[model samples]
Target: MPRIKSPALLVAESGADREGHGLRRSMGLFQLICFGVGAIVGTGIFVGLSDSVAQAGPAVVVSFVLAAITCVFTAFAFAELGGAIPVSGSSYSFAYAGLGETTAFLVGWCLLLEYGVSVSAVAVGWSQYVNELLDSLLGVQLPAALSASPGDGGAVNLPAVLVIAMAAALLVRGVRESARATAAMAVLKLAILVAFCAIGLSAFRDGNLMPFAPAGIAGIGAGTTAAFFSYIGFDAITTAGEEARNPRRDIPVAILVCIGVVTVLYCAVALAAIGAIGGDAVGGQPAALSYVVDEVTGSGVGGGIVAFGAVVAIASVVLAVMYGQSRILMSMSRDGLIPGVFEKVSPRTATPVAGTLIIAVVFAVPAAFSSLDAVVNLCTIGTLAVMAAVNVAVIALRRREPELPRTFRVPLYPVLPLLGVGCCLYLMYETGWTTWLQFAAFLAAGLLVYLGYGRRRSRLARVTPDADATDAVPQPV
Candidate 1:
C-alpha cells in the first residue's frame, strides 16, 4: 500500500496569496481570548444555568467542573492542531488537512449546525433578557407582538432579529472591529457577574444545599451534559489561527486561559445564585439568578442588574458565534466544497460579505420566530459530534505526524483525547432523542448536498491524475 499524504503537511508556502480573499493577519492573543470568552460565557451562564440547576440541584456546580474537564481535554487537542494548521474554519480546516475531502465535508456540515444554530439560539435568549431589562428598569415593556415567538404567545422576536442583524453588520465591517466589540461586551458582562457574585455571596444561606444531588447521578449526568453546551465557544479561539499574530504560541494560551477564566466565573455565579435563593427555588424557574436576587434583597435591583448583564452577554454570544459561522462558510467555499461566492471578500473591509449576508438572513429568520430551546439543543448535538471528531483527529495526527511541530500537546496523548470523546458522546446521549433525530436528519441532508454538488466541485476530488498517482493511498479512515 502506498503511503497516504496528509494535507496537514501541505503548508501554503509563506507569502503565497489566495485570490479574492484579502483577510489580513491582524488578531492577537488578547483578541482571540476575548472572542472565546465572549462567545462561551453568554447563553450558558445567563439562561442555561437555571435549566442545569433544575436537573441537578446545587450539584450543578459539580456539573460545571465536569463540563470544564471535558472542555479542557478537547481544548488541548484543538490547541495542538490549531497551532500546527493555523487556519480559519477550525475543525473543518483541520479535518480537511488531516483526514480527506469526505470527512472534511461532514465536519464542515456539523460546524454549520454548531455555529449557526448556536448564534440563533443566543439571539433568542438575548431578546428575553432585553425584555426583562426593559420591564424592570424603564417601566416599559415590548408589546407581546414583538417580544416572543408566535408559538410562545407573541407574534415575533423583534429584539432577537435586531441583535442578529446588528451582529451581521458588525461582522461585515471587519474582523478586527468585531473582535473589539466582542471584547468590550465580554468585559462588561464579566464585571456584572463578579458584582452579582460579591453581593449574593454576602447573603449566602447554608441550608440551600441540603439535597445537593437531589436527582441522583442520572440527573447530575444530564446536567453535566447540558452544562457542556456553555463551553462550546472556547474553540472559537482556534478558528482565528490564520489571523493570530503568533498562532503557534498564542492560540493554545488563548484557549486554555479563556477556559480557566470561564470555569471560575461559572462556579462563582452558580454558588452565589444557589446560596442566595435556596437551591429549590433557583432550580425551579427561568432567570434563576434574577429571581433569587429579588427574593434576597426584597427589591428588584439585583434582578435588574442580572437582566442587564444577560442582555450584553447574549448579544456578545450572537456576534461571536455568527462570526464563526461566516468564517467556516468562507473556508469551505475557498476549498471548493461550496459555491465560490461565499469566499468573495469585500475589498474595502476584507470580510466575506456574501457569506455574512446569507448567515445573517438564516439566523435572523429563525430567531424571529423559533424557540431558543430547539436551536440550543441542535447546537449542543452538533458541537458534541464535532468535538468527538477533533478528539479522534488529534490522536490520528499524533501517530501519523510524529514529527509535526506542536506548540501545545494533550499531556497524556491518547488518554486525554479518548476521554474527550467519551465525555462528548455521553453528553450527546443526554441531549434527548428529539435532538438526536434532528442531528441525524441534518447529517443526512449534508450527505445529499455532498453527493449532489460537493463531490464534483471539491478541490480534493479534482486532484491531478499525476498527483493522484504519486500519492495513491487509501485516505485515512
Candidate 2:
C-alpha cells in the first residue's frame, strides 16, 4: 500500500522535479489571460448561446450573471491553490495537497472529461461554422453525408478531425509558440465579438426584453447550468502554474482577470444579440450570433465575418483545452498514477508530444461521429463536480494548513467556499438525470483505471521505510 503524498512534497515535485522534466516557464500574465479567454469564449458563446436563450428567454442575461458569480468564487479558490501549489494539474493537484491521492485521482478523472470532451465539443461546433462559412463565401457546402456527425444525419465530420489534428501539431511545436498562437486567435475572436455587439446594438428594441423571466427563476437556474459551461476554461489558467513566468504572482492575477474580462464580454454579447433580434430569433439556431449579425446588417456579409471568427474562436478553444489536458496527464504520470510516457517532455520543444498526440486522436475520433450535445453535457457535469471538489479542498486546506504560504487567499473564507459548493451542486441538480447517468458511467470507467493500475504503481508505494526520497528535493515556497 502507498502512503499519501504530503502537501510539502507536492509543492516540491511541482517546482523542482517539474523543471527536471523539461517544462519551460515561458508563459507570462498576458499569455495566461489569453489562454483562459481562448478557452472560455469559444463554442459556448458562438454556438451554445441559442440553447441558453431557449431555456431562459430574455432573462438568460441573469443566468449569465449567476453563472459568472459561481465561477468567480471558484476562480478565487483556484488562484489561491495554484499559487500555493503552483502545479500543472489544476484542481487535481489542489486535491492531492488538501485531500488525498484517491480524491486527487478522482478529480483528475473528472477533469479528463472537462478538458478532453470540451475539445471534442468545440471541434464539432467548429465543423458547423466551417460548413456555414463555405456556404456563405463560396456558395458551396459539404454534402450532409460528410458534414454531420453520425446519427445526427451524417457519416462523419472531416473538418472536426482536421482541426483537432491541426491544433495538436501546433501544440507539439512548444508551449511558447502555442501561447502566441492562442493569444493572436483570442484577440481576433474578441474583436469580432465587439464588432457584432457594436453593430447589433443599433437595432436594439426595448420590447425584446419584455417578459424577461418568462419561465421564472427555475428558468434562470436552467440557464445558469448551461451558461456555466461558458465559464469552464478560466480555471485552465491555473493549469499553467508550472509554465507561468511567475507562478505565484501571475497565476492568481491571470485567473481573476480572465474571468472578469470574459464575464463582461459574455453579458454584453448576450444583451446585444437578444436586444437586437429578440430571444426567439436566437433560440435553437446553430449560428445564433451570425444570424443576428445577418439580421441586423441585412446581408450575408456580417454572417460571413462571424463565421470566420467562429472558426478562429473554436480552434483557439481546442488548442487551450488540449494544452491543459496534456499537462494534467503529465502531472498524473509524474505521480505514478498513470504511465510515465505521458510525463515525457521533448528536450527541444519542451512539450508533451506523446500525450498531445494521444489526446488529439481521442478528441478527433469521437468528434467526427457524435452529436455535440451529449459530449457537451458530459463536459458540464464533470466540470461542476471538479469545481465543487476544488471549493471544498480550499476550505479543508485552510483548516488543515493555516501556516502554509499563500500568494492569494479567498476573501470571506468559509462563506465563499460554501456558496461555491452550494452553487455547483444546485447546477448539477439542474443538469437533468440523463446527464447524471452519463457522468456516473464515466466515473465508473475512471474507477476501473484507478483500481487496475494507479493504486499499485503510485510513486508513494515505492519509497522504503529507511530512506526519505523527498528530502533530497528542494521545497518550493
Candidate 3:
C-alpha cells in the first residue's frame, strides 16, 4: 500500500514547540493579509496590465471578474484545507495527508514552477520599472545589457539577479523583518494604485471606452487567461502555515481577505488605466502605470511617484514569494524528499538560511537570461495543477478523516470543491500547447527524482506506531 501521511500527525507537527525545530511563528492576521496582497499586486498588476488591456480593451474589467471566479472557488478550498492542515508544506502537506506520497511529491514539484519561476519573472518585471523610475528622476537608466534579459535583446539582466539576491538577504535576516517590510510596502502599493485611479479618473473620457470589445469574445477569453494568474499570490499565504500565530484561524481568514483586496485592486486599476488614456495607448505599453500617470498629469512628478511605488511593490513580491518558496523546500527536506541542507534552519535567525541562498542563486541565473512572457504561461500551468490537487485533497481528507478538527469548512460540501477543480481545468486549457508539453516534462522529471532519491530517503519509508505517536491537535481559537 502507498504511504499516506496522517493529518493528525501533520497538525501535531505544526503545533510542536521543540527548541530550534520549527519556523518562527511571528505573523498574525494583519501580516498574513499584507503578504498575500503584496504578492498578488506585483508583476501582474504593475506590468502585465497592458498586455491584458491590449487583449480585452476596455472590457478588461470583465476579464478580471471572469478570472476571479476561478480564484473565488479555489480560495474556499484553500481556506478549509489551510485551517485543517496548517503546515509549512501548504498544499503539499495537505496532499501528503490526504493523498499518497507519490502524489504529494508531484504537487511539490509543480510548486517549484509556481513560486520559483514566478519570482524570477517578477524580478524581470522589476527591471523595467527600475529603469522607468531612474529615468524619470535622474534622466538616466541602466543599459539593455545590464537591465534587459538576453532574450530581450541584451546579454544578461544584472538588475534581475541583483533584486533576487537582495530579497534573499532580507529573508535570511528573518521572517519577522520580511513580514514588516511586506506590510509597509503593501500599504504603499495600495496607496499608489488608488492615487493612479483617482488621477486617471479625473482625466477620464467616455469616448476612450468606445469599441469595448475590439477583439470580441475570443479576445475577452484570452484576457481572462492573462488575468487568472494574478490570483495565484494568495496561496503564498498558505505556505506560511508554520510561521503564523494562531494559524488555523489566521491562515484561512487571510486567504479570504487577500482575495477580496486583490480583486478590487485589479479591477479598479485596469478600469482606471483604460479610462484615462484609452485602450489603444494603454495596450502593449511597458511601464504602463507610470505611462498612465504621465499622460494624465503632463509632468514627471506623478509618473516618478508611481514608478517609485512599483519599484518597492515588486520587491515586496520577490521577498514574499521567495520566502514561501524557501519554506516549501524546507518542508520537503524534512521529509527527506530533497537535500538535507534545506532542512537546516539557522538557530540564530530561525530561518532556512542555506536553502534560501540556494533558491536565490538557482532562480536568479534564469532571471538573468529568460524571456518575460515565455515562462509566465509555464508558471500559470504549474499553479493550476497544484490548485487542482489541493481541491481534490480537501475532498479526500473529509472522507478519510471526517472528525478532523477544522476551524473552517467549504460551503456546499463536495460541490464547491468539484467546481474549484473544474475552474482550474478550464483555465489550464486556455494556455498554449507548449505549456502542456513543458508541464509533462516537469512531471516526468519529478517522478524520476522521487523514485531514485526521495522514495528511498523519505522519513515515512519506515513508519511505525511509536514513531508516529502524537496527541490530537485542537482547533485554534
> lDDT winner among the candidates?
2
Expressed as tens digits, the lDDT of each residue in 278-347 for candidate 2 is: 9988888999988999899999989999999999999999999999999899999998999998998899
Please provide, for model 1 over 310-354, each residue's C-alpha lDDT reduced to its tens digit, 9 standing for 90 to 100.
988888888888877777787788767799988888989988898
TM-score of each: 0.94, 0.96, 0.96
On lDDT, the stronger of 1 and 3 is 3
For candidate 1, give the lDDT. Answer: 0.81
Of 1 and 2, the candidate ahead on TM-score is: 2
Higher-scoring candidate on lDDT, 2 or 3: 2
Model 1 worst lDDT run, 10 consecutive residues: 9-18
- State the lDDT of candidate 3 residue by residue for 188-229, as single tens digits: 999999999899889888889989999999899889989877
User: What lDDT score goes with residue 414 in model 2?
Assistant: 90
Model 1 alpha-carbon drift over 4 Å, by segment: 1-21, 464-477
Q: Which ten residues in a row have the lowest lDDT in candidate 3?
A: 464-473
